[model samples]
Target chain A: MSSAARLSPSAPGLSGTGGHDDRKVPPVADMARIIGLSIPVACMPDVVANTALLHGYADLVGSFVLPDDCEPAYEYVP
Target chain B: MTMQGHKAGAALAIAADVRAGHRSAVSVVTDVIADIEARDTRFNSVTRILGPAAVAQAEEVDKAIAAGRDPGPLAGVPFGVKDLFDVRGEVTTAGSIVLRDNLPATRDAVVVERLRAAGAVPVATLNMDEFAYGFSTENAHTGTTRNPHDTARLAGGSSGGSAASVAAGLLPFTLGSDTNGSIRIPSSLCGVWGLKPTYGQMPLGGVYPFVASLDVVGPMADTVEDLRAVYAIMAGGAPVGEPDMGDVRVARLGGWFADNISTELRAGIDAVMAHLGQDRVIELPEVARARASAFLISAAEGGNLHLPRLRRRSMQYDPATRGRLMAGAMLPAATFVQAQRFRRWFRDHVHAALAQADVLVAPTTVGVAPRIDQPSIVVDGKTVSARANLGIFTQPVSLAGLPVLAAPLAVDGLPLGIQLIGAPGGEAKLFAVAAELQRAGLAACRPLEAGYARKDS
Candidate 1:
């Protein structure tokens, strides 16, 4: 891939206009509710902003195609 | 007793002086404590001084030497720990007010125990980002740690205090945990030597957990030699053998690693490549995705670790940390799982890169330390938060679980650094390259002048 293409913003979640499936991922506030977190009213804006940022990153990671045989990197010995 | 001109081997020299009765450990510890008390006001690097306990430990070392017994290799050298490490009889705050009321630790952290056993004394607890979450050490509970070279700029963190203390010559060495660029970021910005050892290499017992899958405790120091010596003690005292410089293969990481760097930093890397007589540049695939995976995993793990406490005392946590943790806790499980699976793929590719070269070179941060008032860096023509974006280079490397030695570049202005990356358990190779750079005058920690202190406040 060209450097310009690589540097271009690729996360649809950040733009909220294309390629994001809203039906699959709930809104930030709704997700918080489902997870049983009581985000404070004053803190909600920052929480939403950070969550939105993570959503973009999550979209980027989730879009990558992985082989079925791939396993999580969780094992650590000594 | 001053460490002005003794950056290269301060720890070893201090140990030799103590063991040979040239200086008493008690006196050394006392002088360090006094220096910290007198000099740390401008930097805000040291949060607590382990005065009485450190002095008592030094007395024991003195008695051991008097009885014709070995006091250990790092005898009487004073060091500090990032506030997350548990020290017996002290609260491990992890740099937040939320844990201020917690009970005192019953024992030292495993790495701290190792250092203490080796005759090194922990003289102070240094400042850090709350829960080791941020890159810039602008702690909400403790004030920000200022860069020693120029107090107006930030001392990159979550190991900001650890790096600053060493850079300022307050201590010969310090211990810090690196999950994602914590040690490397601070070390680079403060112009010190730091090692982010391979994952799972250092025992984490009694150390405050950050990201379970990623956390690795290591040492920061004023010189490559001191860093190696401290790392040996932390890694169970087996001395790391030096690799032949002639046989060590070097490559510069291009692709994502080559972007957003300053002219000075670019020149620095060019000089290093020239010195090694190689211009081979290796580009790793999917580096953007690798960095993203690390970010996701860290957030998810760190959020889960603090969920119980955050649930009870949400308001007590740092506002910046609390918001991010809550967001991480709410992440879809599928996203977290995908990140983990992608990590395996990324690690495989990184290993393949290592097969071609023994060591890979990259910049630790894009530029020098950001200004304190404006805590941000320009990336791809956009100004972003330094706290979140400074780790763009280091995070991807952290995902591969490689050992990276952050080496300070010898420059004329504010300090810059480069990462010498090696395969897992390839720290000896990293150390060899760092020593070569230091010897060739291509890399060395810039010493802060004695009169350099914050004048604004």
Candidate 2:
């Protein structure tokens, strides 16, 4: 709710952004485990911190809507 | 030949001489290799000089000319590739320690092979953001590629080395990849011609994959003609020649593309529009959302590519890229799906805007290159990291899958540029407008020394 909590990934009170996330964004530590279950404990901190930042950006993208008929731009001749 | 060392010579200048049999390709290669050795220390643009293999290729070109056979279109022109592109017998580092031990590529990237077939000698591998992930070429392993125009400033890249090398006049032309403005940002900062061709139009074979969907390789050069010529070969012969400029319907991009621009840059774009006699201005809807989609898609895709490696060697990546890829790898599928779908809608809007004009012009960067010590630009009056936010104008355009030529504006002081956007597969129309500006002296490549000369001491 406060500016500091919104910016800090470590803050537990950070809520869903733009009503796009059904659940509160995962805590940084939880995101690290979500990426690689067996990832080294030491690497988790960086992963969590990074994942938290990415989730912040993903929030911006999640707000936009597209029709289901719009196909992804995946190109390969084969 | 003087070799034009740091004089910001054009690739077309050398190709003309070699094509005419006036100068031996062998001699040109020898001199260029020697010149880069002599002059590249300042910019640190070149990572490794090809040496023996390049010399041998040059000799073959000389033999062809001596034997009365043509030496090809780019004959004897020395060029470089971003280290991510495979060069035969060289390890493609992609600016990381992670790939230092990977075996040498058995062959060249498809585009590299195309250039070689056209007689352009690949003399070296240039520096880049590790895994082509960062906007600044401040490679932790390879060292930051200092702007040749001013050693203390950022060159603005992932393709920093490619653009810097051209700006430094060490190479006439170079190859670089653009995902989220990699080529365009660096080209605009370093003041060279860079083309990010229509997405999926050019072959990506043998180049290291970053964001598979958005990644596109293109050429950077000191002259627009050379840029188009090299592109012709890369796109599979001579460009359908330059198109008629009179037929092009040009308009300046307004709204998101116009904010936070400097006065000099504003004048430069104003001059360009006046030169074209196009006073029209068009704005696309939801550009901010389009940029966000491009960003998320790139992160998710780039993260997925490096996920396996990160799981094993997370500590090895540049900390900046590591976190990004990790975040991307963990991005929810729903988010990625939303980004992709939004990409399609945003692209349609952009294309629809293009239907009214043959080309859309926007400032490549918010302003000039940022100083190295203070590596931030004032965007919308807030100082932000130049590395992450350099693509503000470019990222939105990338979503459209259109061809954009990064045209350096001939303004005073540090290098600045404008983006000339064309409709899908409309490279020729963009080239026509770019050529018209270059001819009118409104936009021209300002080599490093030329920019430094213009700098206020």
- TM-score top scorer: 1
Candidate 1 docking DockQ? 0.57
lDDT of each: 0.87, 0.81
Error of 2 at B321 (Å): 0.9
Task: Work out how many backbone clashes candidate 2 has.
Answer: 1
For model 1, what share of native contacts is present? 0.71
Interface RMSD of 1: 2.3
Error of 1 at B409 (Å): 0.5
DockQ of each: 0.57, 0.38
The residue ranges of model 2 lying beyond 4 angstroms of the native Cα positions read A1-25, A37-46, A75-78, B1-9, B448-457
